[model samples]
Every structure is written in structure tokens, then in C-alpha cells.
Target chain A: MAVDGTRPYGAYPPGSETEQVGIMTSTVTILYFAALREQIGRESQVATLPAGGMTVTALLAQLGQQDPRVAGAFAAEPRLRVAINQTLGGLEQIVRPGDEVAVFPPMTGG
Target chain B: MSVPGAGVPKVGSPEMGSPELDSLGAGIHVAVQEAPFDTASEIARLSALSDRTGGVGLFFGQVRGGNGLVSLTLEHYPGMTEKILHALAHEAVQRFGLLGCTLIHRVGTLRVGEAIVFVGASAAHRGAALDATAFLIDRLKTGAPFWKKEEFADGHASWVAAREEDEHAARAWSQDTPPPA
Candidate 1:
């Protein structure tokens, strides 16, 4: 809920993640896995969150705004799993600065 | 370096990397790698790790053929995979009164009939070791961060979905009682 209402949800405005650079308050490295990774076309990317941190749900919601492909990926799958750092996390988990967040589909390996 | 989509699923961070230790302790041996492991060597290692090992149980899983499946790819979060697998192995040792335990999962492309996973447990009695062996794999199927994607000979591939049965099995272990010390 800490996301700024004035600006839009997507981290970069065409490239806000890198354009704003040093001005952003919180930066998180987001990781993609499994089907999501295949769809996103990248393994990992950095994103920014407004001050005071935001819930994992909010972060994903923001990332969903990145572009049509990202948006489509989030919209396509409803059961996206999340983890803060390496431990599994709930939707309400508060993602803070410098956190390594992972988003992936449900596990199926034996 | 991990080449994500290059068909080679790497284990651990590029810098941190998977630890090559044979066994961290007398009670736990966990590894996430791409190479096919020697099951006999692993069982012998676990047996020799503890002096009281009287019962050693093992379960080895391989990629199944048929259904037009050509190969299967396993994906996992490097650092997290290692951490969780080790924790589960340690827990089984305690919960089953096991003298030692082993859990290994292979990542990357595995053709049909190729080995994919190995779970083993050793204890003072047959019952504890047997139950622990089951517990280790059941819990791992649900708790571990690994994911499986199946590729068909028809040129199609899809990630496997999680199964409810695995979740139930992992939970059943929680309710079961451990053997007496």
C-alpha cells in the first residue's frame, strides 16, 4: 500500500527501473522461474517500490503493469507462487528494500 | 554460470554455487546437481557416516517413458533448493530416529529412463528407516522448490502442475509419530 498514488504502478515509465536510478527509495531484485521465466524472457530484473515497503501482492500487481507480456503472464496464471529471499512467502508478505523476491509457478519435481 | 533457457538447469547461485561437500554431518546429506549420482556410493557413504546404522532404506526415481515423452527438465532455485532439501533431510533424521539421511535431486534435461532423484534413510531399526525414507520423498515432493517440465517427442513442452496427493502425503508425515530413541 506504500506505492505512490500520484505515479502509475509500473516500475519504469517506458524504463523507470533504470531511468530513475538513484532516486528510487526501495529496489528489489525480482526472479522469474519455470513457465513465468519462459514467458517473461528473462530470468531476473530489478524493480522499485515506494518508501515503507509494500506487500508481495502489491509488488506483483505493479510488475503486472510493466508491459503487455508481463501483464499477460500475470493475468494468464492465477496461482503464481512467491518467496521473499529464499523462503516461501504469502501474498501479504512485506517486501522490503534489497529483498530478493522470486515468482514462479507451483512446484512439480520429485 | 546458469544458462536458464539453454537446457542446462544450474544449481545454486553463479557466485555462491552448490557446495561440493560429501556430507555436512553424520546425519544429513543433501545435494542439488545435474550429474547422475552413484546410488551405491551414496548408500555406502550414509551407512559409514554413523556407527549405529543398522537399517538403510532408499528410493530412486527415474524419468518414465511413454506418453510420447522424450525428456523432462527439472528447474529449481539454487540457493533455496539446497537450503530446503538439507532442512528436510535433517528433520527426517530426527522424526524417524534415523542415524542418517540423504536427499539428492537432479536438474536440467533428463531423458527417459534417466535418474532424477534419490532419497535414503538409515536408522537402528528397519521400521524407522523405511518410514523415514518415505517421509523424505513425500515431504520433498511438496516442500522442495524444484519444478518439472515435460517435453514431448512431438515438439511440445509444458511444466508439470503440483499434485494434491503430494501435499496430503507431506502432511501425513507431520501427524505420524517418530520412533523411540
Candidate 2:
């Protein structure tokens, strides 16, 4: 079965799947800045995440493979931090569709 | 304008006596300016702002002619920029018993010799005030998310490289032990 990206992670919302059949999938927003932004070209972009299960690290790996610059950026591992909707989260955290994930260098700001 | 803590009236206050000099007195004021700063006004504001505090510390960071670079532009992450600045100010106040402090950082296009940042601090003694001023500026330069794009005289523009030295300066502040009484 082709997994629909629009469906939220885990169990689908009650009855909504049946109510709206064949709806095009939606995409999530990813924000990049500084070196990351320069490499990505665009400051922010919308992407569709694979269904079933995907950890933050896994998602990052996929992004890296898609863009060589992104791959080089995350090669430093812990040097880069990830935030979901502005709050810091670990790599294992599950990301849902429509979530805004921001990737940037370790914060040096006061 | 009137002095910060003084009973005098504010600079622009209608009740003030002279148009040139307001109740706040004639000297120290802090402003994030688009045009080049007036050194005379800055000196006046600094002098007027001082009172019981025996020491006044100030830092003026200007955009350097980056190897013959004529123009520079600063970019910052909107909401996050202001949030970080406010947090830094609060931290400075808590760490040092500062009488008063002012920080003004300009964002956007700027030319060489134009002031990019201003940090002012006042305390009971000079030592504390000077240290606090240094600490604030050091932290702001390294920790802040602002990025600078330098346009050289050759018409080429590039993002300024992040300096490890700045990080070291900020790290020193974290390691410092409180001074002895």
C-alpha cells in the first residue's frame, strides 16, 4: 500500500480518512539559516516526510542524501542542533507532517 | 535630556528649560542610529547619564573596511534577535550590580567607520562597570545570531567567517570567578 504523507504519524484521525478520500498529501516546512541556509539556497522549503515512522536523525539523513551541501553540514553531528517549532528536541523525537523543523548551527547567542 | 536616575526632566520633555539641553541634562544617551553617530552627542549623553556611579564604561564597535570592503549588511533572525538581546541585558544586570546599562546594535546596510554596536554600563566602581561592559559586548558578538555580509571595493560580497577568537572571549566570561571585595 502506498503510504499517504498527509496522514499524521501513527494512527489516522478517526473517520477523517473515509470522509476525504484521495486527498493530495501535504508538506511540512523546514527552516534553515547561516551556513545551512547558504547551502540550501532557499531559506525555507516544504517537504513531505515518509510515512510509518521516521526519527529526527533519520529525517536529517534523508535530507542530507538529497542535497550534498546538507549532507556535509550534518556530518559534524552534535555540532548542529534541531528544533521543532522553536523548542529543542532530541534526535529520536518523532516528527509529524506539517511540523516546522528548524536546523542550524549550535546557538552562540546570549 | 534629564539624567537617567536624576530628578531632572527628560531631554524632549516640554517642561525642560532649554531646547538644546533638556531636563535629563545635556549628555549621555544611547540610540541605535541609521546614520553615522554624532560623537559629541554620545559624549554628552554619557556624561549626563553618569551620577553616583564612579565609573562609566563604554564600547563602540564600528564596521571595519573589511580589506577594502566599502559596504556591509547585517542580517538577523527577526523575533529571535530581540529575544536574545533582552536576555543578555537581563543577565548583565543580574551578574553585576550595574547601576544602569544600554545596548544598541544596528541591523542592515552600513558603511566603514559607522558604529555597529554600542554598550554602556555604570556601576559603583570602575572595575565592575568596565568588566560588565566588556562581558556584554563579548557575549553579544559571539552569541548573537546576527550575520554580516561584506561587500568589498571590488564589488564582491561574502558572508564574514565566524571567528573562534570571539567564542574564546565569551568562554572566558563564563569561567571567571566573582572578584573579591
Candidate 3:
């Protein structure tokens, strides 16, 4: 079964998440900033990934479930950008343990 | 301090004293900090490092006062910030034959009328130096991992939104394939 609030688009069945009961999960550091930080009420938090590995999109889905406000932010997908360990990253990027992931709005710097 | 060029490719001829080689020390210096910098002194230092430098082009981005913004705050990804700036400077040096380059961006809370960014490029000719300076500034505006939040005089605050015009400006460099000689 998919973790409640963690699955976006319902790509996988909810109960399927339990199939990995014997498998190991990975940890990822997720950071929020600016408006996201304000909305989420924290700068950073650690998230657990599925047994195999989670992509940035999957991570967002997981985080979106953790809080209604976070879920609302993701409603504006494609408008949000993320960074994996400080470099600009995309949804397809696989997240591994010890990786620091940052989610924020589009940059407006010169 | 030296700018770390991680993913940025090495550029400029060996004789040009690129910081990439390190033997002659780094000609490209980048800094991302909370403290303000002495713009004139910094430009002077970059100019003195490269003997072949004939023209030094400089640009300063400042927070405009009376523009409804009372204060501004900049946020960036730590390690990635310097790396990206170094990469931009590296490309400028290699693409335009720059003898040296310097980039500085300030973070934390800043008041209206304070300088926010500084970019300088030095080359044997004015064209190269000027072009490189433009390239660095334009790219930094869109490519860097920095974000800006503006606080109005009335206490209202909002994140500065990314503009399509800025993206269009950055895309020009990529679209101009083969680059003008």
C-alpha cells in the first residue's frame, strides 16, 4: 500500500508499500526555504524513502502528505524547483540516503 | 579566498594565468557571503593579477531605494552557490579569453540602496572584457541558485517572482550557436 499522503498521481496501489516490509528504507534530508519554509514552519527535516529509491517527484509526494500546507504548495507543480545537495535538480533525479534535498519556489536573483 | 571550480570546465590558454591551472594562482575569484565588499578594491585586485589585462569591465547590482522595497533578503544553497558562480566565471573566461574575473554576491538582510552583486571581467581587449562581464551577470541572474524576498515599507513581504524576460535573456547565449567570432 502506498503511504497515505506520499503518493502523487496514484501510480502505485496504497497497500503495495507494505511489500517492502523486509527491505531497508533510505533517509533523505529535505530543506524548505523562503515561502515554503514559512508555510511548512521549518527549515529542514528528514524523510524516509521507499525500499528501493525515491525520485524527487516521489519525495515531493511523500512530503506533500506530511502536511496539508505542503500538499497545497505542490498543487503548483512545475512552478517549484528543487536542488539535490545544493545543485539544481529535477523530478527524475533519484534520491539516496545522506543526500540533502531542497524545495523552493523559482529563483529571482541577479 | 580561491573560487572552487568543480563542474566548470577549465578554460583560457595556459599563458593566460587561469585560476584553473593553480600554478599561477586563480585568476577567477568568487565569493558568496553576508558581509558587504569594497567594490573598488576588489576590481583593482583582479586587474593587478593579470598582466595582459587591457580592459576591465565591471557591473554593480544595487537595491533601489524608494522602489517600495524597504529591505531585501537573499537566500541560496550553500555549496552549490559558489560552485555555480565559479562555473559561470569559468565559462566567461574561456569563452571570451578573459585574463581574470571576479564575482561577489551578498546574502542576509540588506537595506534599500545597498549593493547586492558585483561582477568584473578583464581581458586583453575591451570587447572580450565587456562581453565576458555581460555574460557573467546575465547568467548569474537566471542560473544561480539564489532567491530574493522583498519587504515593502508597509511591512508586507513577498518573494520576488522569476520573470520570463530574464529566462529569455539567458536563453540567448545558448541559442547563438557557434558564437560570433
DockQ of each: 0.31, 0.09, 0.29
True contacts kept of 1: 0.55
Residue A106 in model 3: shift from native, Å? 1.3
> Ten-residue segment with the worst summed lDDT in candidate 3 chain A?
A7-16
TM-score of each: 0.81, 0.64, 0.81
How close to the true structure is residue B24 of candidate 2, measured as C-alpha lDDT?
26
lDDT of 3 by residue, B29-144 (tens): 88877788998898898779767878798999988777688989887765567768877777787788777898999887889989899999988898888777877887898888
| lDDT values, one for every candidate | 0.74, 0.61, 0.72
DockQ of 3: 0.29
How high is the lDDT of residue A3 in model 1? Answer: 28
Candidate 2 accuracy as lDDT: 0.61
lDDT of 1 by residue, A1-110 (tens): 22222322111122233234334447877777788877876666778777788999899888887656667887877888898877899999999877778898877778
In angstroms, what RMSD does candidate 3 have relative to the true structure? 8.5
Per-residue lDDT tens digits of candidate 3, residues A1-110?
A: 12233422212221133234314346666766667766766666667776577889888887888878788766854588888766788889998765767788877776
Residue B55 of model 3 has an lDDT of 79
What's the CA RMSD for each of the models? 8.1, 12.0, 8.5
Q: What is the lDDT of residue A8 in candidate 3?
A: 29
Q: Report the error of model 2 at residue A6, Å.
A: 22
